[model samples]
Every structure is written in C-alpha cells, then in structure tokens.
Target: MKVLLIGPAGSGKSLLTRSLGEWLRRGGYSVALVNLDPACGYLPYKPDFDIRSFYDIRKIMRKEKLGPNAAVIRVHELLSNNLEKILPELKIERDFILIDTSGQMELFVFRETGPKIVEALKDAVGIFLVDATLMNPIDLVTLKLMAQVVRLRLNVPVVPVITKVDLVPEINFANSAQLTREIRKQKGSVVDLALALNKSLDGFDIPVRVIKISSKTCEGFGELLSTLYETYCECGDLT
Candidate 1:
C-alpha cells in the first residue's frame, strides 16, 4: 500500500509520516519512507528516494538565472519528466510506502506534476490533513472547497484528517466547550454546514475521521492506525 501524507506547512505531515511508518512496521509490514521535498534541509528519518536527487529548487534557480518561485516551478517540471526514472529505483517489496510531500499544498495537489506522481504509483491513498487549530467555520468551509479541487484532479481515495489534536485541549477549554455547546445549540448552522459539505462530495458516506495524535504522548495513535488499516483494506490495497 502506498500512502501520501499531505498538509499545509507546520501541519505535522512529516512527523505523522514517521509515526505511521513505525506503526506499519510493528504490524509486520515492511515500509519504505520517501521524502518528496526537493529543498528540505533535514529530515527526521532517511528517505529511500528523495526528490533532491533530481532537482533542488534553490540550486537550480541560481544556476538558471531564475528567481526562487520560478525555481520551484522548474523543479516541479523536472520531477514530472523524471518521475518514471526514479520509480524503477524504488524497491516496492514493502507492504506500505509512505510519501512525505511538500508543504506547498497547491503546488503538488493541483499542479500537473503532482497528479502525474500519483498516477505512477498503483493503489495510492491520499491522506489530506487540516490543522485542528484551524477548525473554525470559515476555515472548514475553505477546506471543503480545496477538497473539491483535489477530488476533481486526483483519482485516489482522499482521506481528510484533523491533526494537532494536542492543541485542542490547549484551546481555551471554556471557549472550546462553549463552541461545542454552541454547536449543539445552533445545530442549524454548524450541522447544516457539515451536511452541505458532505452533500457536495461524491462519497458523502465516507465520514471524515478526526485523529488527535501527539508525537509527544502517542495519543490517538491506535485509532489512526486502525483507521488506516481499515481504509486500505476497504480500498483493496491491503489483504
């Protein structure tokens, strides 16, 4: 099973990738971890295949007389063309493969190169995460909007996850509880928004799972693993 972990910057995608890798291994599965960040300075776990081998945005921009933004665009193009070349080098014997993608959400998810990479892998799963701290009405609405974009472009199963639940408890307990109470009070507003978002999706029945994982306490790790296993099995990626 190949899974892609995607989220905005500072959304804990890398840490989740590492934790998931360990979890899969403990379940008797060999896993390969790949870092797709071309400009990443350091990674907590070594990647089997890194995009830096093909293109480094900063270095390429300097050599080609391009600005930083242009450099990143060029890097994307290079990866698109060279994706096949790198795939052969990957040993896919592992039962699970976790890909750590760039924090540049739009660059990868909506762009041509991003879609091509997903096509190169068989039975790929897309795990899109939203920071729990960003769980406000307006932001949740925007997230659903982006989910539509991803669904339209990618042909893989998209799993939406709420991350950084550690911050949930830290959120003003009074304010958080009050919001929940308000949600209960104003079910018309809150529940209506959720229902509308679900109606907008193709598979409205696939409920969004909330995972409050802490690399610190390993909280919610079990739930996350169970969800991932069931998801993969249901998608026929796991036997």
Candidate 2:
C-alpha cells in the first residue's frame, strides 16, 4: 500500500517515515521511501525517489529570484506540472511505499498538487501526524478539524496519528464526551468554540482512532502498522 506521511512542520513526518520504513523492512516487508519535500535539507533515510533531483528548490530560488516561501510555492507549481514524470517511479511493486511530503503542510494539501498527486496514485492512504505535545483539548479539536479538511481536499482516507508520544504524558480521553468535558473545564470563548466544533465533528461520525507513536523509541509501531492494514482493508481484521 502507498502511505503518505503528512503533517505540519516539525510534527515528525520525516522521522516517522524513516522509522516506520525501517521497521517495515526489518519485518521482511518491501518498503519504498519517497521524499517529496524540496525544501527539506536533510532526511533521516535516503529516498528511493527524491523530487530534488527533478526540481531543486534552491535552484528555483536562484533562477526565479524568489524568497524561501515564494520558492516553495514555485516548487509546488513545478510538481503539479511535472507530476507525470514521478508517477512511473512510484509504480514499482512493493509491500509499502512511504511518501514524505513538504514540511509546510499548506503548501502541499491546500495547493492543487496534493490532490493531483494522490489521484495519480489511486490507492494511497494519508497518515496525518499530530504533535503529541500540542494535545490540549482545544488544540486537539483544531488539529482534528485540519485533518478533516485534508481528507476533504484530497478526497482520500486519512488516519490521524499522534507523534512524539514520548514528549507528552499518556492521553486518556476515551471519547468526544471526555474531550468535551475537558474543553468545558477551560475558561475562554475559544474553548466554547472548540466545544461547538467538536460536537459538529462528532455528528459526522468520523471514527478517530488515536495511534500514538514515538519515532525516537519506536514505540507503538505495531499498533500503527495494524491501523494501516485495517484502514487499507476497510475491515477490523489485521491479518
């Protein structure tokens, strides 16, 4: 299955891609790592297919005389235009293909490139990573909303993953009811807004199975793998 690792900058997408790919390989699964981030300077694992070889962001910045942000935008434009070039590389047989996306989440998901790329793959599942340290009830609601938006934009199945679990204490919110109660304890109009949004999201019947993992320690890898299988198969059975 093709799994796209997507999240905001510093949310551990690349690290998770590296660690997860390594774990899968060690388990005797054939995994291909694809780096789609042109602005990323260093990656923990070498991608079998790297976009920089096609469109270098630094070269775009130099040639177009654009700033860092503008150059990134230009890179996405190039990616959208030249997507056909990368599709063949992704067609090879593999048990899993883990794609690391751009660090700036908006540059990828909000742009035309993200959906186009996913449509090309046709069988891709998105793993939307949320930083565990940012998991206050209000922030969690906000992230869930963002994940929903990403799913809507891409029109694909996206699993919300909590990354950096080692940095935070155990998260024990059993359901949206627990989350709503926690939000009510906070004192702010923002908290009220979050409550309303959370309720609306619950009405949609989105099953958010929280899979927390620590890339540094490889904790929760098994649960993550099972969730991926379950998501891809659309069945409860992991086998």
Candidate 3:
C-alpha cells in the first residue's frame, strides 16, 4: 500500500517516515521510501525516489530569481506538470510505499498538486501527523479539522496520528466529550469556536482512534502498522 506522511512544518512527518519505514522493514516487509519535498535539506533515510533530482527549490530560486516562497510554489508547479515522470518510479512493486511530503503543508495539501498526486496513486492512504506537544483540547480540535480537510482534498482514507508523544506529558482527552469538557474550561472566543466546530463535526466519520507515537522511542509502531493493515484489508491481515 502507498502511505503518504503529511503534516505541518515541525510536525515530525519526515522522522515518522524514517521510523515507520524502518519498523516495516524489520518485520520483513518490503518498503519503498519516496521523498516529495524538493526543499528538504536532509532526511534520516535515503529515498528510493527523490524529487530534488528533478527539481530543487533552492536551485529554482537561484536560476529563476524567485524568493523562497515563490520557489516552493514553482517547484510544486513543476511537480504537478511532471507527474508522469515521477509516477512510473512510484509504481514499483513493494509491500509498502512511504511518501514524505513537504514541510510547507499548505503549499502541498491546499493546492492542486497534492490531490492530483493522491489520485494518481489510487489506493494511497494518508497518515496525518499532529504534534502531541500541541495537543491542548482546542488545538487538537483544530488539527482534527485540518485532517478532515486533508481527507476531503485527497479523497482517501486518512489516519490522524499524534506524533512526538514523548515530548508531551500525556494526551488530555480520550474522546470528543472529554475534549469538549476541556475546551469549556478554557477562556476566550477561540474556545467557543472550537466547541462549535467540534459539534459540527459530529456524525461525520472523523478519526477517533488514538495512535500516539514517538519516533524517538518507537512507542506506537506496532499499532500504526496494524492500523495500516486494517486500512488495507477489511480482514486486517498483516500477512
């Protein structure tokens, strides 16, 4: 299965990509890593397919005389246009294909390139990482909303994962009711907004399964792998 690791900057998407890929390989599963971030300087694991070979953001800035933001936009534009070139490489047979996206999440997730790439991959599942350190009830609600938006855009199954759990004391709430109660304790209009948003999200199949993982300790790798397997097969076969 093709799994896309997507999240905001500093959300540990790349680190999770490395950790998850390593975990899968150790289980004797064939895994392929694809780096789609042209702007990323370093990665823990070398990608089997790297977008920098096709278009580098820094080089685009230097050659095209564009600013960093403009370079990022331009590189993604190039990627969208050149999907045919990249798609072939991604189509190689493997037990798992892990794709690490750009740190500039909005540029990718909110734009056309992300959906286009996900559509091309067919059965790709998105792993939306949220930094656990930012997991106050209000912030968690907002991040959950963002993950829904990502699912809507990508039109695929998405798993919301809390990353960097080691940095946080503990996840505050187990369910939406607990989350709402915690949100009610906070002050300001933002709390009201979070509460209303949380209510509006009711009845929709939002990801409620908590998969808190720490790439540092490999705390939840087994659960993550199992979740992915369940997504891939209704029978939840890991074999």
Candidate 4:
C-alpha cells in the first residue's frame, strides 16, 4: 500500500513520513519511504529512493541558467516526462510505502505532475496536511478548496490531516458542513467559492477525515495507522 503525503510547506509531512514509517515497521510491516522532492535541502529521515538522485533542481538552476521558479517548473516537467524511470527505483515490495512530496504545492498538485505521480502508484491514498496551529475560517476554507482539488485532480481518496496538534488544544474536523453553511450566510467571493466546493463535495460523499497528529507527542498516530490499514484493505490491497 502506498500513502502520499502532500501539503504546503512546514506542514510536517516529512516528520509524519518518518513517524508513520517507524510505526508500521514496529508493527512488523515492511515500509519504504520515498522522497519526491528534488530540491529539498534537508530531510529528517533517509529515503529509500529520492528524486534528488535523478534530478536536483538546484543543480539544474546553476547549470541551465534558470531561476528558482523556472528551475522548479522545469524539474517537475522533467519528472512528468521521465516518470517511467522512477518506476524502476520504486519496485521494492513493502507492506507500506510512504511518499513525501515537494513543498511546491502548485507545481506538484495543481498541475499535471501530481496526477501523473498518482497514476503511477497503485492503491495510493493522499494525506493532505493542514497546520493545526493556523486553523481559522479562511485557512480552513482554503484547505477544503485544496483538498477538493487533490480529489478531483488526482481522482483518488484523500485524507485531510491536521499536523502539529501539540500546539493546539483541540482541532475540529467534523464541523466542516456547518462551517460551509456559515460561509454561505456571509457575503464574499472567497466564501462563495468555499460554499460551492462544500456543496460539490457533499454530493459525492467524499470521505475527508480530519486527523490530528503530533510528532512531538506521537498523538493520533495509532488512529492514523488503523485508518490507513483499513483504507488499504478496502482498496483490496490485502497481502
């Protein structure tokens, strides 16, 4: 089973990738962690297969006379074109495979590269990280919007997670419907967009769970593990 970790920068996906891999390994499951960030300067855990081995955006920027933004775009386009090459490195069989994505959300998810990566993986579920300490009406609405984008664009199951729960006393994931109603009652273009996304998602009954986890305290990792295993089993990815 493959689990894709995606979110904005500083969303703790790297930490969660390391933590979840340890949890799975402790449970007697083989785990392989993949770092899909070509430009990552540092990673907390060593990856089994890192995109840097194939393409490092920083090196390309220096050698090809490209700017930071252009270098990232070109690198993603390269990854998209050479996705087949990545397959050979990812052929190791494991009970769980955790994918740590790039921090460039738009370059990865909002574009063609995200879907291409998802299509390359079998029975993979996305874990979208939302910073718990930054939860507000606007942030929540924006998160819902991005989450919908992942579901619609990638056409796979997405689990919305709240990272850094150690900083917050409580995080609410169940109130999204009510939050949408409140947003609709208000008058604004952003709220209007949020309301529309809520309605569209409601019709599809897409399961967007709000999991609160903290790598500091190991909070909610157990629930996350159970949930992931259940999801994989439901996908008929049984060993």
Candidate 5:
C-alpha cells in the first residue's frame, strides 16, 4: 500500500510518518519510509528511502536564484522527472510504503506538480493532516478547501487527521455538545463550515475521519494505528 502524507508546515506530518513507519515495522510489516522533502535538512531518524539523493534544495536555490518556495517547486519539477529512478532505487520490499512529503501543504495540494505526484502514485492512499489547533470552525473551513483540492485534483482517497490533540484534552469527541460549544467559541459558526464542506463534496464519498495524535506523548496513537489498519490493511494481512 502506498500512503501519501500531506499537511501544512509544522503540522506534524513528518513526525507522524516516522512514528507510523516504526510502529508498522514493529507490527511485522516491511515498510519503506520515503522522504520526499528535498528542502528538509533534518530528520529525527533516518528514512529508509530518501529523495535527497537526487536533488538538494540548497543547490537548486543557489543555482537558480530562487527563494524557499521556488526551490521547493524546483525540487518537485526535478522529482517528477526522476521519480521512476527514485522509487526503484528505494527497493521497497514492504507491503506498505510511507511518503513523508514537504510541509508546504499548498505547494503540493493546490498545484499541478502535486497532482502529478499523486497521479503517478495512483495506488497510494492520500492522507491530509490538519493541526488539532485548527479544529475550530473557521480553520476547518480552510481544511475543507484543502481536502476538496486533494479530492478533486489528485483523484486519490483522502483522509483528514487532526494532530496535536494532546495539547487540548478538554475537547473530547465523546462530548458533542461541549465540542460544538467550544468550536463555536473558537470559531463563529460550526454549522456553516460543515454545510460548506457538505456542499463541496456533493456525491463524492470522501472518507472524512478526524483522528487525534501526539507523536511526542503517543496519546491517541493506538486509535490512529487501528484506524489505519482497518482502513488500509487487508484482513489480518498487515496487522
């Protein structure tokens, strides 16, 4: 199974990718962690497979007189051409593959370069992580837009995840009234965003599930794991 991790910068996409890969491996699934962020200089742990072997953003920026965003776009252009070489070189023997993409969420989700990557990896599961801090209605509206972009342009099944929930324990999914009230206080109108998202996803069976996870504390990690296993794995195949 191919999984594409997409999220805004500093939204815990890389951390989740690392934690998920290690957990999957511990569960006896041979997994390959592909680092697709060429501009990313540091990783907490080494990735099993990385694209930095093909292109380095520092070099691209210096050679092309581009800013960070432009450098990322350049990396995308380079990777699109060289993906065949890159993926094969990964030598992924696992049943599942995890792609840790750039934190520039819009760079990928809203651009042709991003759609091309998803199209190239059509077999992959597309996961979009929204910061738990953005669980408010207004931010959810923005996330809904991001989700729509992923669904409409990428042609991949999208999963919405809320990260950093450990930071806020009072807002529990089990308490709908409290959650709704908190959401209203945080954002003006929860119903408005929900209605907007519902209209945008007309006829499209988008699997929208909000998962809470903290890579630091491992809070809600088990639920996240169970969700992925149930959603993506075969009958006891990758369990």
Candidate 6:
C-alpha cells in the first residue's frame, strides 16, 4: 500500500506523512517513508529513501541559472523520463510506503510529469491536504475546483483532507455548502468574490470526502485511517 500526501505550502504533508508512517509502524505494519520533494531542505523525519539524493533543485537552479519555478519544472521533467530508475529506489520490502510530495501543488499536479510520476507507484492513493485555519470561503470554493482538476488530471483516487483542525474546527464538508448559502444572500464585495469563483467552478464535478485531521493532537487520525481503508484499501488490507 502506497499513500502520497500532497498539499500546498504549510499544509502539513511532510508532518502527516511522518506521523502516518509512525502510526502504521505502531500497528505492526512495516512502513517505508519516501521523500519525493526535491525542494525540501530539511525534514523532520529521516526518510528511508529521498529524491534529493538524485535530484537537487538548488543545484539545478544554480547550475542552469533558472528561477525556483523553472528549476522545479526542469527537475520534474527529468524525473518523468527517469521514473523507471527512481521507482526502483523508492521500492522497499515493506507493507506500507508513505510518500511525501512537493508542497508546490502545480509544479507536480498541473504538469504531465506529475501524473506520470504518481503512476510509477504500485497501488498508491493521493491525499490532498488543505489547511483549515487559513482557508476562507473563497479559498474553500477554489479547493473544490482544485479537487476536480487534480482528480481529472491524475486519474487516481484523490482524497480531500482538511488539516490543522485544532486551530479552526468549524471548516469542513459543511463549510462549502454553508458558504454557498451565505454568499447567495450577500452583495457588493462578497457577491463580487462569488462571481469570480463561479467562473472557476464551471466544471467542478469531483466528489470530495473532506476529513478533518489535527496532527498535533492526533484528533481525527483514526477517522482519517478508517476512511482511507473504506475508500481505497481492500478489506483488512492496509489496516
């Protein structure tokens, strides 16, 4: 079983990947933590395999004289061609493999290289983490649209996870619907924001299972695993 934790900057992908690795290990499952983020300078947990060993984004930036964004694109393009080699290094004799992805969602998600990289994994599920405390109503709308884009782009099982719920426990699946009602009754600036979002929401049809998680307190951690089991894993598999 392979689980890829993905999110924007400050969305706790690395932390959750580390925590879940520990959680699964405690449950008697052998877990291998793989860091797929070439841009990660420091990691809280030492991964069993790290992509920085092969591709260094900083080195690419300095050697090629490319900006951060351009360097990321270059590295990803190289990985897309070298996935056959990279996939072997990531493989290990473990029941569960936790993959920590780049914080830059578009650098991997929007590009063709992103899906190809994910396709290299065997039995992998993508976890999309959203920072609950930082998201506004408009951000929530954009997330829904993004969920659709990611799902369609990757053609994989994408799970929507709302992280850091301890900071703001009010946002979740209901917030999206509640915000829709609130905005319908608003005008001026609020209505203007809604109009802007409506254009982006044109073709959003992805079904999102928004589960809240607090890594600090481990609140909702069990529920998150349960949902993963029900949605992605076989019976009694990856439990």
For TM-score, the strongest prediction is 2
For all candidates in order, the CA lDDT equals: 0.68, 0.83, 0.81, 0.77, 0.70, 0.76
The sequence of per-residue lDDT tens digits that candidate 5 reaches over residues 1-239 is: 77888888988888888887777788788888888888887886588877787787888889999999989988898777776876567557677788888878777777678778777765666677887766664455456567557767777666667777787665464223343454455534556665555445443553445566777677776776666655554223322
True lDDT of residue 126, candidate 4: 79
Task: Encode model 3's per-residue lDDT on 1-239: one tens digit a residue.
Answer: 88999999999989888888888899999999999888888898989989888886777899999987678778888877888887787787999999999888887888887788778778887788989987888887777687678888988767778889899857867478888899999998898899888887755644345577999989988988887666656423323
Best lDDT goes to which candidate? Answer: 2
Candidate 6, TM-score vs. the true structure? 0.82
Model 3 off-target regions past 4 Å?
Answer: 231-239
Please state every model's RMSD to the true fold in angstroms.
Answer: 4.3, 2.9, 3.0, 3.1, 4.0, 4.2
Q: Which stretches of candidate 2 lie over 4 Å from their true place?
A: 235-239
Better of 3 and 6 by lDDT: 3
Which window of ten consecutive residues has the lowest lDDT sum in model 1?
171-180
Question: Mind giving the per-residue lDDT tens digits that candidate 6 earns over 41-84?
Answer: 78989899988888888889999999988888888899889988
TM-score of each: 0.80, 0.91, 0.90, 0.85, 0.82, 0.82
- Deviation (Å) of 39 in candidate 5: 0.6
Per-residue lDDT of model 4, residues 1-239, tens digit only: 78889898889989989988887798899999999877778998989988888887878999999987678778778877887887878887998889998876776788777788778776687788888888865566677667767867886667777789899866554366666756756766777777777666556554544667887778888877776665556545323
Higher-scoring candidate on lDDT, 4 or 5 = 4
Better of 1 and 5 by lDDT: 5
Query: Residue 61 of candidate 2: its Cα lDDT?
Result: 91
Model 1's number of clashes is 0
Pairs that clash in candidate 5: none
Q: Is candidate 2 or candidate 5 better by TM-score?
A: 2
C-alpha lDDT (0 to 100) for residue 111 of candidate 2: 82
